[model samples]
Target: MTYTRFAIYDAPSDDALAEFGATWLGWDIRTGCATDQPDVHGLDDITMTPRKYGFHGTLKPPFRLATGTDVGGLQVAVTEMAATCAPTKSGGLALTTLGGFLALIPTGDLSGLERVAGACVRALDPFRAPQSKADLIRRRKAGLSARQETLMLRWGYPYVMEEFRFHLTLSARMPDQDRAQWFQTAQANLPPLNEIYAIDSIALCGERADGRFELIQRYALTG
Candidate 1:
């Protein structure tokens, strides 16, 4: 299958959590197919934004491939990189509102996860095609700071490196009044969240022609 863009993600390894994500989002990225959503009020509308990408935290945002790069090379390079890194232990995950959206955020030390995300951003950057003028303009319209502009120029993305905050997004930007209702809904539907969240592997995902991202492969951090 041809993919227009690709990204790296830390997808859930736990079966129940993974299933809940797929069902709730109404897209099973692993299977590259849509799933039946749970019976919840306004669920489809709420999940529309994140449904296509499935449930995962971004390690590297989507990017077009560079002129000389190919998926085969990306796979090999990512595998090598993963083999050299150790897994990260997120003290635990908590569901909370972020920038008007609901997401699951890590509550523990972030050094290990930061290192992994940063390495992926830098090491695999050679395969990233330069951002187009329109893309840059669109991003800047969000009101970037000076440091973000610098990061954007150097890394093809601004919210990376020191700016990275790992979160598994669960909803689109909600109205102020609707936030509490959805938060309660999410908490009631989600699986147990008290267990330590481990970032032991990363998945390579490809955005299909339809704009939905599908899993390519998952590389384990064996180091």
Candidate 2:
């Protein structure tokens, strides 16, 4: 099956670019891997495991399309979907700990963002391939809540709508002790958090044979 994902990307500013480069260099050294991990939050002891998928904040979860569903149709739907969603206002982002890893999550009320995300996921659901048995088992391994299970069955992903939290991932996962060190390192290296960041576009990404995600379409929020 073809692997694909839909996500919203923070358009990189000059500062963001430089910060990403520096953070990646540090993570590469810490992980002892030649290539930098795709997400730039930070790599700590807990999240040092290598993931085949590259980093991105999921907007619509990944799915393989049904046999006859064309890419052109999906593109049109995604574009239309994006055009109807309004951008987030007032709330800014902060580097915060999620479970075991540090990430940039929106601070304050984010019901608007969640609504947009949910609408996008639902709007595009018709084109998505039904989950395979293996996919369901893999999802079950995460020990989903009842609501998440309902979401999974209805929308092909568990984390959207009320479950959504906007975050740009930094690391795989890290231990509690290493968390402070990593957080400090990341805060020092990342772009300043005080700036107003926009969640104005969703990027369509595809997985390559080697399993890294590459950008395909970047749909702007026009609403």
> Whose TM-score is greatest here?
1
Q: Pick the candidate with the highest lDDT.
A: 1
Give residue 16's error in model 2 in angstroms. Answer: 1.5
lDDT of 2 by residue, 1-223 (tens): 2456433333333355424633443332112224543453444333444233334456776677766876778889888988888876436678888878777776777776677677777888878888888988999999999999998888777877788776767666776888888888767766556555556777776654545455666788887
Cα-based RMSD of candidate 1:
0.9
Per-residue accuracy of model 1 over 1-223 as CA lDDT, tens digit each: 9999999999887898888889989998788889998888799999999998999999999999999999999999999989988888967899999999999999878999999999889888999999999999999998999999999999999999999999998999999999999999999988887568899999999999999999999999987
Worst 10 residues of 2 by lDDT: 25-34
Clashing pairs in 2: 41-170, 42-170, 46-173, 46-174, 46-175, 47-173, 47-174
CA lDDT of each prediction against the hidden true structure = 0.92, 0.64
The per-candidate count of clashes, in order, stands at: 0, 7
Regions more than 4 Å wrong, model 2 = 1-55
Q: What is the C-alpha local distance difference test score of candidate 1?
A: 0.92
lDDT of 1 at 43: 94
